[model samples]
Target: MEHREPGYVADKAQLLKRLRRAEGQVRGLQRMVEDDVYCIDVLTQVSAATKALETVALQLLDDHLAHCVAEASAEGGPVAEEKLREASAAIARLVRS
Candidate 1:
């Protein structure tokens, strides 16, 4: 079954654009390594890319909580608890990262 909710649909375009830019940054990092650019500079770019990805993750988490989890909570049952647990685990993983 296809789970097609509007999770993050509103930020879809902006998210894609950010992800593409992050992709380009990763490519640039590869090139920098191949060209033997300064280690610090490359690390700086890596940090930028990492932050970009983190931002995407955060936005996704927010959307999930606002849409899926909220809906599930309103329903009030095992599914709601499952959704809350899922969100908590996701947030934990993000925090660890």
Candidate 2:
């Protein structure tokens, strides 16, 4: 059977909003570069954009853990273990980034 990722479906609107905002920030960054903006100012904007994206990632992770992982854990056995492992791997990748 196929499993649905609840977080994405549940937070679909909010997630899309966040992603769109980040995409706008990226476009602004490109404009700044094209306009020959100061290095430090551009760097600051880049940092802000990165943080915004990271916040979205963290929020999604929290939702996944609370909804997906929690439900899977309650189910028990292989599926539960797989979900936990997937979450752990996601966390590791996030931390490394």
Candidate 3:
């Protein structure tokens, strides 16, 4: 896989921790399915995983705007504006999803 930027990598570490927890939740869900556990319990686990992912996405987006976009803008010219546009589009797409 490609390397993450330093700031992003820091956020990614936290996200990865959350993902691992979510992974455990998925395994629990799988066991629930296998053991004929309640349907609502499994659904609740799924919802938790989705929310965890969304939280990670929002954290990364906030960091990108605060650091990368800010740095690019400070340097002047089109790069900063382009980065902001890209980040905005990405955020929009994420929200729509």
The model with the greatest TM-score is: 1
CA lDDT of 88 in candidate 2? 99
Query: Model 2 TM-score?
Result: 0.92
Q: All candidates' TM-scores? A: 0.94, 0.92, 0.78
lDDT of prediction 1: 0.94
Among all windows of 10 consecutive residues in model 3, the one with the lowest summed lDDT is 1-10
lDDT (Cα, 0-100) at 22 in candidate 3: 75
> Over the stretch 1-97, how does candidate 3's per-residue lDDT look in tens digits?
2344744766777878988987887788889899998888889888987888788788888888887888778987888778889898989999898
Clashes of each: 0, 0, 0
Error of 2 at 29 (Å): 0.3
Off by over 4 Å in 2: none
Candidate 2, residues 13-79, lDDT tens digits: the string is 9988999999999999999999999999999999999998998999899999999899889999998
Q: Indicate the worst ten consecutive residues by lDDT in candidate 1.
A: 1-10
Kindly list the per-residue Cα lDDT of model 1 for residues 1-97, writing each as its tens digit.
Answer: 2376668999999999999999999999999999999999999999999999999999999999999899889989998899999999999999998
**Stretches > 4 Å off in candidate 1:** none
Ranking by TM-score: 1, 2, 3
